[model samples]
Target: MTERIVVVGAALLDGGRLLAARRSAPPELAGRWELPGGKVEKGEAPEAALVRELREELGVEAETVERVPGEWPLRSPYILQVWTARLRPGSPAARPLQDHDALRWLTPDDIWDVDWLDQDVPAVRETLTRFPTETR
Candidate 1:
């Protein structure tokens, strides 16, 4: 069996708005929306990986808030783990600096508006448990 790879995703929240990123590379996933994050490098803590990914992929400094409760499988040998995170004080607003071409801050009321990548659907649904549907 192939070794398992853990992909970390951030359910990045601010003022009751969640940040969603639109994929811009890899034609198969281009134009699809998903939480912004990347793989956890070997030997790196998942939280650290998440923070690094947010910086690399979104150009913002952030901190992990809490881990979402469950794990979801991606393609073979890969599994998804999500964490709730918030931008550090004074951090730049998120931007599509890398693999993403667009960024949207979606309030709970309209979070469903974006067309999310299929593998992200369930993990996002699980995030609803942490994010109240009503904006604060």
Candidate 2:
């Protein structure tokens, strides 16, 4: 059986930019940039897992707008579910929790500058394609 792993993440458009996180430790590719979410717990639904992760990682509430419609395999052997979400009215300020060192709001061109987890790269690329940066 393929060991299944689910990553719950958000594509928050803050001021028309997407949010990303810099990871800290333990998880092998620590210093790389990643979407602000985590592994889905056993028996938890992926959408619910995303909401929980956003609240835990970023101190915000999110509502799923859509699932990105594909899976990307990680080097560590888990397939990722990239979900798109919208911020809810009562969302709290984002604060680093768990293994994230910092957070950033990035435009499409600037996204490639941050080191991303291998699996997430495709999803991020797909997202950028869908929501291109407005050229100034």
- Candidate of highest TM-score: 1
After superposing candidate 1 on the true structure, give the runs of residues whose Cα lies further than 4 Å from its correct spot.
132-136
TM-score between candidate 2 and the true structure: 0.87
Candidate 1 residue-wise lDDT, 1-136, digit = tens: 8998999999998888889999999899999999999998999999999999999998899999899988889988899999999999999989899999999999878989999998889888888777755652
In candidate 1, what residue range of length 10 has the lowest lDDT sum? 127-136
lDDT of prediction 2? 0.78
Candidate closest to the true structure, highest lDDT: 1
The lDDT per prediction is: 0.91, 0.78
